[model samples]
Target chain A: MGTLYEDRLAEHIGKECPPIEAVDTVCPETIRHWIEIMEDRNPAYSDAEWAAGSRFGSIVAPGAMMQVWSMAPHWPQRDLPELPIAPVDEVLISEGFTDVVATEQSQQIHKLAKIGEPVTFTVKLTKVSDREHKTRLGVAYFVTFEYRFTDPRGDLLGTQSFTYMRYRPEPESESADEPAA
Target chain B: MPTDWMKPHLKYDSVAWEDVSEGDELPTHVREIDTSLVVLGAISAARDFYPVHHDKDAAIAAGAPDVFLNILTTNGLMASFVTNWCGPDWDVTDISLRLLIPAFPGLKLTTTGTVARKYEEDGRQMLDVEFGAGTDYGPHCKGTATLRRP
Candidate 1:
């Protein structure tokens, strides 16, 4: 396998390809579990009567819950067969890419996701950048990617932008000179 | 007489509206960022490929001081603090956050907020909530939030 930097960059720049893949996952249990774990006592997420009387008209998933749901499809083990896509972990690990970092993330909630509604997430690698910084190993390249989320009906729910910088380790003896300056 | 179902978490049930002031400080909420929660949050949010969140070595190699906090996790923490204080009756209308410093794993962070301004907007009571997160090192993030009272 070649370096992830080389492979991903090639695919991104050469093929005019989108570095990130879009995938979807649906499991009512996931949302239910989140509500329980967080101890979210909000009637909109737990009580049928309260939810029915609310604007959403059902036990809608919390905004933060929907954010979590959006990322479920990227886990390595699920290997969403319908999409024929690799989990983000497998994809990065396969290309000998390591050290992914999220520099920033911003989300805007447009609407709520109701219970029993199959929430579909569309993860796309919106941008990629190669950055070089002086380190013990001199300079290294860093790659960043962004992912956006939407519902099954194609209504925009929120957007999450993640920046990951990838690079190899620097060799020793490269910075042996020591000068007090 | 029937009891109010939402009485437990309501401000009216305990404290009176006259007690809270524009500059009065709310109780502070503190948390330490652990690698496990950070990783779980990152993966769960579909931010799957970032190793710097889970891999310490990767973070060092990338030019970051350490496995830094993701923006989503920071936002979640801020939102949670507000919700915890205001109770479930209030809803978060908007949140604007700015990260000042990197919050690494094991760092002690304290979240503090104050009522900046309050007014009636469209027949609903609104509170201009200002929040911030700080560590022993310094401030990590500062922002304002809009909360509507029921």
Candidate 2:
């Protein structure tokens, strides 16, 4: 509705933040849990004996789990820093555009994560819509971030570009100048 | 329980890179979408805390019919589809995804793909597979995945 939020988002474009490491290193337990839920039965991901004979020579984390390895932890309430995009989302929320949804993602994998390796990620705001984009739900702004995932040795494992649509719901009735309580 | 007890019984053979053709078709993989997939996939698997992915009321309020699959899980499923077809030795080098519709509970998700290109890059045999997943409501997601042969 105003240029304030757009100006705020523009300032963040192309800004990269410090890399954040995963709370836990890549481990077998988490990999098992993920493939179990997805019903992925690939022997290289689950069977130790089979993977030992396979080209990998050991169990490997699923290539698709690249982002999962760096996802923020939920429980125990550790004192982790906020992602670089938190402030950008705050700027949008301040203007009543609170809801957000992932609309697209693209990943480039240089290497799959291996067991016992610590994964870290650095994120940069890549793009922001110059104007409001109208969608089925409501008028919105699209924000995109690029994430680079790397191993402890600083070797890149993968890269992902994630895009989210942030929007406010349309009012059912035409009400103007509604007072804030 | 011992990890040995967790191993699944092997059923399929690996696809060798030497035999892959540009027009080769991958076997279709079908999954039943339910509450467990939508919830556990978001929370325990993908570690996504986004309310719309796990909370039904929150999803409705956010303009979704119900709790839907998160992007990471969707990508994971797509990866599984490719690996399941190509077997255990190959490496997936890239995945590009475009979301069209929500994969909701009660829908049967089916993925099908074709090898779009077969070539050698930097002495590594590579295959680019164009894949798409859909349900009764039409296509849900589509993408191209690049696989490196071992």
Candidate 3:
């Protein structure tokens, strides 16, 4: 990667992107679909009777269902004009660093959202590795994107932090020339 | 990334907060990763279209053995592992994960957790549980999460 390009990448740090628009609200139907794949038979996530008789008094969405609320759409549509929240992935792809992988993730939930409440997200470019890393996947740069989720009533749900490695795989030959970073 | 529901489904009574002791062992949860629908459902649920998670040729080209599981799915698995063991009222408050190896199609993941500490914090019954998933690749994923039994 050129120094100028690297500098441009560095510029992304601290940049805040607009929140995803029209986030799907949580509902029993959505919750059921998730528990099906997870086999998460916890009554609270699915059984209305069990949930209503409990402290929550209604069916509660699983707290771990947080990230699914704000994942990047499979088909990309431009939502925010002030800041295109998803450019780092594009930059990585453009730079031939196409092998993407998640390295770490963490979340702190203020509380779980209720059914019929919409979930929205806002993210910030938290970090760009100062130095390139070498691995079986060739030279890679670490990109960390942090997300915050809120419900329709302006209540805080939780904040999720995850890191992705944008890597270019090394060629088969042991002595092949490598790109400059 | 489990697709079909368990054959003999489970019915659980909410574990009493007082009954859970520090150093208690939680039940093990096994996740069989079938590359077909199971893994696909997981990635699709997250809307994660990254090729490494799907598309066999793209995954091989990207240096992965095959279409592999994504972290969001792992997060769900980890949460379910804890919540299932702690019973109905128990919920996950915080979870942090570190992946040591890629979980592939043929892999079988056996997840277990140990209660590290149980205490009352601000009148909330809390347990800090350390959990891990064992795969064909050895120790695959490990993390600690806080679960609250109210």
Best by TM-score: 2
Give me the TM-scores of chain B across the candidates: 0.82, 0.93, 0.86
Residues A113-168 of candidate 2 have per-residue lDDT tens digits of 87888999888888887777666556677889989999888988889999888877
TM-score of 2: 0.90
For model 3 chain A, give the 10-residue run with minimal summed lDDT: A172-181
Rank the models by lDDT, top first.
2, 3, 1
Local distance difference test, candidate 1: 0.56
Label model 1 with its docking quality class: incorrect
Which 10-residue window of candidate 1 chain A scores lowest in summed lDDT? A13-22
Return the candidate ranking by DockQ, descending.
2, 3, 1
Write the residue-wise lDDT of candidate 2 on B1-150 in tens digits. 145665645434778877889999999888999999999999899999989888999998876789999988898899888877887667788898888788999999999999999999999888999999999988889999998875
Question: Least accurate stretch of 10 residues (summed lDDT) in model 3 chain B?
Answer: B1-10
DockQ, structure candidate 2: 0.45
Chain A vs native chain A, TM-score per candidate: 0.58, 0.87, 0.81
The lDDT per prediction is 0.56, 0.82, 0.74
| Superposition error at A110 for model 3 (Å) | 1.5
Residue-wise C-alpha lDDT for candidate 1, range A79-120, written one tens digit per residue:
442221223334555554444333344455566676555555
Q: After aligning candidate 1 to the native by TM-score, how far in Å is the CA of A90 from where it should be?
A: 21
What clash count does candidate 2 reach? 0
Candidate 3 lDDT tens digits, A1-181? 5673466577777887666744577777767777776778787767666666877777778887788776555566646544433676677778777776787888887878778777878888788776667754577777787888887777888888887777877864343232211
Q: Can you tell me which runs of candidate 2 are displaced by over 4 Å?
A: A1-6, A171-181, B1-8
